[model samples]
Target: MLNKVYFSALLFLSLTLNAQTSPCKAAHIGKFQVDSGESGITVIERNKKTQTEINEKMGYKARYDIVWIDDCHYELRNRTVIKGKSWEGSSPTDILKAEILKVVNGKVFLRLGSNFSDEVMECEMIKIKS
Candidate 1:
């Protein structure tokens, strides 16, 4: 009877821990920072249907309309360049694909690519706020 009780307790504890570690879609709705190497850091804020990115060092800010294909994948359609005259060439029709490759602790590994180009960029974004 003692062995049975101990086994049940262990099973319950394992299940409880697994539940706690499960990922939620809403967890990614927050502010994050991406180190853009020579370009400096880019701060990104994600919401349900939109995402805003600001590169303070470059004096650039842009907003994108997000179309979530799935929990892990999404497309960003450039809506407008809120600041920076250099970004005026950005087309509203430009589409960028982004995927959340993995989330560990407070960092999210992302893969980004452009629909009009073959180039792909991968970076780790540190969560700044949730």
Candidate 2:
């Protein structure tokens, strides 16, 4: 029984430490490719991003904007550009707002809540070393 309890405690502590100091944190700050089913795959970069690079084979174009509301939270534009300008303060649509801007298990995901659809969706992004 003591051995079981010790193992469990050690496992929990290890997981907590890893989660807090994840090397995958790089995935949150650079360019990444994400597979969006019919869209196949798309490239997302820091700040300025073009959604049309989804995939020629898939014949699907993506449209989105990731506006960093803060370091850890983000808001997306329902429209292509933010208030017809790329500036942060410009009036952007809140229809695609997302939060939880952290990385986990070598991937960064944006939780889509009531923006693109009524259901909650998670879009994962891989890190680009460049």
> TM-score of model 1 relative to the true fold?
0.77
lDDT of 2 by residue, 27-88 (tens): 43556787777746766555443222244454444456556565556555654542223435
- TM-scores, each model vs. reference: 0.77, 0.51
Candidate with top lDDT is: 1
Question: What are the runs in model 1 whose C-alpha is more than 4 Å off?
Answer: 1-27, 86-89
C-alpha lDDT of all candidate models, in order: 0.84, 0.57
On residues 1-130, what C-alpha lDDT tens digit does candidate 1 reach at each position? Answer: 9999999999999999867743536435899898989999999999998899999999999898989887788899966889985454556898999888888888888899987789998988898999
Pairs that clash in candidate 1: none
